[model samples]
Target: MQTNVYNIAFAESTKQVYLHFWGCNIKCKGCVCQKVVYDFMLDRNMHLHLAEPRGLAAAPERFMAFNDVIDTLVGLEAKWVLFEGQEASLDPQMPFIAEALHRHLGTTNVLLTNAFVMPDLRHFDKVAVGLKAFNENLHREYTGESNRTILENFPRIFHSGVPMMAETVLIPGYIDYQEIEQIAKFIASVDKNIRYQIDAYFKAGNNPWRRPTADEVDRAVEAASKHLNNVYAYKGSEPREFGVKSIFPTEAELDAAELAPAVESRHLVYA
Candidate 1:
C-alpha cells in the first residue's frame, strides 16, 4: 500500500524520525501546519528555501511502498518513529503500518492524534493526544468537534499500557490558565502519572491569537503541575536548537527529486 507522506524529519529529543501522514479529521482554528504544508505544496521548492537558512532538512511529498518506508527508516538507524500530521489514525492501514515497522525494523512507533477515532494502540510505544479543551463548548468552538470521544479515548489509551500524554495549546486568552488548570485536574483524576505538555500557541498565517509571555507560560505549567506529577510546556517560538544536514543541493534539486505516483489520493486533511 502507498501513503501520501509529505514530510519527514528527525527529532533530537526522542532520537527518532517522523513521517507526516496527510489528513486530519478536525479543523483546529489556529493550527500552524496549514502554513507549513501548503506553503510547500504551493511551491514544492519552499521547503528547500526554509531548510537551507535554518540548516533543516526534509524530503518532498511522495508515495512509497510500506516496505520502502521501513527500509528507509532502517537506513537512518531510526529506533523510534512518530506517525503524525493531520491525524495519523485516519490512515486505514495504520495498524498494519505500525506492525510492519516493528516486525521488520524493530522500530518503536508513536502516534500524535486528536483522538477522535480511537485506534488499536497495542503496537504503539507512546501516544500523544491533543485535548483542545476541558469544557465541551470551548472544544467544539475551537476544533469544530465535541471533546467527548477525545476525552474518553485518553483513559482507554493510558489503561492499555501504552504510554500516553495529553497536550493543549496555550492560546493566550482563549485556552488560557484557567482552562489548563481544569485540564490538569481532569487528567489527575484519571491518572496523575500521565504526562502533560502545554504547547505555546504562536501567531501563524491568519491566526489572531498572540503567543503567551514567558511569565504566562511559566504560570500555566506551574498550575498544571499541581494536578499531575509530570508536566511540561513547549515554547514553540523558542525551540531547542539542533543541527541538521541537507539531502539536496538546492531548491531546484529538491523539486527535481523523484516521487512515486500515488495509487490512492486523499483530500487535503487539515487547515
Candidate 2:
C-alpha cells in the first residue's frame, strides 16, 4: 500500500525522526501545522497567514517515497521513529508504517495521535495520546470535533497493554491548570504512574491564546502532579539549535524561496 507522506524531519530533543503524513480528521483552532502546511502548499509567497479557504485546494507536494523514508531513517541511525500527522491514525498504512519502522529498522515506533480511532496497539512500541481537553464542550470547541470517540478509545489503548503517555497543550485560560488537573485525574484513573507531559502552548497562526509563562507551566505541572505520579512540563525550545532537516520548507525557507507557480486543480484541500 502507498503512504501519503508529505515531510520527514528529526527532533533533536527526543532523538526521534518524525514522518509527517498528509491528513487529519480534526481541525484544532490553534494548530500550528495547518498554517505551515497550507503555506507550503498554497501561499507561494510563504506568508505566515492562513491560506484563502479556496487556495487550500492545491495538492501538497509528495516529497518522498515510503521506502526512501525508511532508508533515510535507517541511515540516520534513528533509534526512535514518530508517526506524526494532522492525525497519523487516519493514514491507511499507519500500522504498516509502525511495523516497518520496528521490523526493518529496529526502531521504537511511537504514534502521536488524538486517539479518536484505536488501532491495534501491538503495532507500536509507545503511544502518546494528545488529550486536548477533558471537558467535552471545551474539547469540541478547541478541536472542532467531539471528544467522545477519543475518550472512549483511551481505555482501549490502556488495556492493550502497550506503553502509553498523555500530552495536553497548556493554553492558559482554555486549557488551564484545572483542565490539566482534570486530565491528569482521568489518566491517573487508568494508570497513576503514566507520565503526563503538560506542554506550554506556543503561539501559532492567529491564535489568541498567549504562550504560557515559565511560572504558568510550573503551576500547571504542580497542579497536575497532585494526581499524576510522573508529571512533567516543557516550557522552552527543544534543542533545535542542533541540526535538524526537513523535506518540506521551514518558515525561514518559505520566506526566502520564490513563490510556487499557480496550479489548476488539486485532489484534496484543508476542509
Candidate 3:
C-alpha cells in the first residue's frame, strides 16, 4: 500500500517518531508549513524564531511504501508515532499504518489532524484535533474551506472511545480569545473534560497576522478555561527535553536531493 508520509523524525530520549504527511484538504492562511518544513523540535538549533519558507525540506519524490515505512519505525525502536504534518487523516493508509505499528512494534499511535476528514479511530491511541475557529465565516476565511464537517467530526471523534484533545492557534487580531471561548464551549458541549490547548500563532508566509504575546495566549487560555475543565497554552517554540534527528531522507540524502520545487510540490499528495 502507498502512504502520504514524506518526512520522519525520531526523538531518541522520548522514543517517539513523527510521521509528516504531505497533503492537506484545507489551506490555512498562516500555515506553519509555509515557513518551516519540519517540526521545530526536530531542528538541530531549535530556533525560537520562525524560519522563512525554505521550500520542501528533504521530501522524497514519491510517497513511501508500506513495508519501507514499517521497517524504518521498527529500526527506530519507536515507542510512539505521531502522524502530523499538513494532515494525517487525508492519508488513506493511515489506519493500516497505525494498526501495523501497534501490532508489530507495540507502539502508541497518535494522530494530529485538521479534523477536516475523519479516519478510522480504532487503531489510534490518541487523537489531537486542530479546531481552527468556531465562527463559520471566520473559519472559512482563514482556512479556505467550510468548517461544517470539521465541527461535526470533532464530536464524533470524541465519542469514538479513543482519548481525544482539541487545540487552536491564537492569531492576534483574527482568532482571538472570544473566538477561542466559542470553540471551548463547543467542545464542552460534547464533554467538559476534553483537554483543550491554545497555541500562539507564529508568523508565516505573507500573512498579516503576528504572533500572539504571552499575555494574549494567557487570555485565550483563560477564556477557554471557562468552558473546558482542562485548558493549556503553548507558545509553539518550547525547548525540547530530548534531542530529535531526521530519520527518513537523512541530512546526507537531502543534501544530494534533487526534488521538485516547494512551491510546485510541497502540497501535492502522491497516491
Candidate 4:
C-alpha cells in the first residue's frame, strides 16, 4: 500500500515510533511542520535557533510502501506508533495502516490530528485532537479554517469508545490563557477527566505571534486545570528524556530531501 508517510523515528527509552505523514488539511500560521519536520527532540537546540521556516524540507518524493512501513516497525519493536506531522488524518491509508500495525505488531496506535476531518476511531487506540482555538473567528484567523466540524467531531469521536485527549498551542497574544480556559471548559463539558495539554507555540515563518514564556504556559495550564481534571504544559524548547533516532528517511535522506510539486496539491484547502 502506498502511504504519505515520509519520516519515521524511534525512541529507545520511550519505545515509541513517530510516523510522520506529509500533507495537512488546514494551514496554521505557526505550524511546526513549516519550521522543522523531523523529531525536534533529536536536536532541540538547533531547531530552537532556526530563525526562518524550512518549508517542506522533510517532504518525500512519493508515498511509502506498506510492507516497508510494517517491516520497519517490526524491527524497531515499537510499543506505540504515533501518527503525526502535518496531519496524519489527511492520509486515506491511515486506518489500514493503524489496523495492520495493531494486528501484525500489536503496537498501540495513536493519532495526533487537528480534528477537522475525523478518522475511523475503531482502528486507533488513542486520538489526540489539536484544538487550535475555542472561538470560531480566532480559530479561522489562525488556521484558515472553521472550528465547527472540529468541535462537533471531538465529542463524536470521544463517544465512539476510543480513548481521546485534547491539546492546543498557547500562542501568547493570539491564543492565551483566556482562550485555553474556554477550550478546557468545552472539553470538560464532554468529560472533565479527559487529558488536556497546552503546548507553547514556537516562532515559525513570518507569523506575528511570539512564543509564550514558561510562566505564561503555567498560567494557561492553571486556567485549563480549573475546568479539566488532567492538564499539562509542554515547552518544546526543553530537552527530552530520551533521544530519538530516524528510522525511515535517515538524517542524510532528510537533509537531501525536497518537496514534490504534486505534494502541494494534496494539502486540503477549506472552502
lDDT of each: 0.71, 0.73, 0.82, 0.80
Worst 10 residues of 1 by lDDT: 48-57
Model 3 residue 181 CA deviation (Å) reads 0.9
Which stretch of 10 consecutive residues in model 3 shows the poorest summed lDDT?
262-271
lDDT of 2 by residue, 1-271 (tens): 4676776776555566777777788888777563355332222322333233323333356555667777777777778887786777887777776777788778888888889888766678889999999999999988898899998898789888888999999999889999999999999888899989988776554556777888899999999999989999877443324445553435455443324454456323232
Clashing pairs in 4: none
**Count of clashes, each model:** 0, 0, 0, 0
Q: Candidate 2 has which clashing residue pairs, if any?
A: none
Off by over 4 Å in 4: 44-46, 49-58, 255-271
Q: Tens-digit lDDT track for model 3 on 48-146?
A: 355444333333465688889999999888999999989888888888999999999999999998888888888899999999998999999999999
Error of 4 at 59 (Å): 3.8
- Return whichever of 2 and 4 wins on TM-score: 4
Best by lDDT: 3
lDDT of 4 by residue, 1-271 (tens): 7888987888888899989898988989878665666655554224453364433333345557878888888888889999997898888888888988888888899999988987877778999999999999999988899999999999998999899998998989789999999999999999999999988887775677777888999999999999999998887665557788776767565544423233543421100
State which candidate, 2 or 3, has the greater TM-score: 3
Task: TM-score for candidate 3, please give it.
Answer: 0.90
**Model 4 TM-score, 2 decimals:** 0.89
**Candidates 3 and 4: which is better by lDDT?**
3
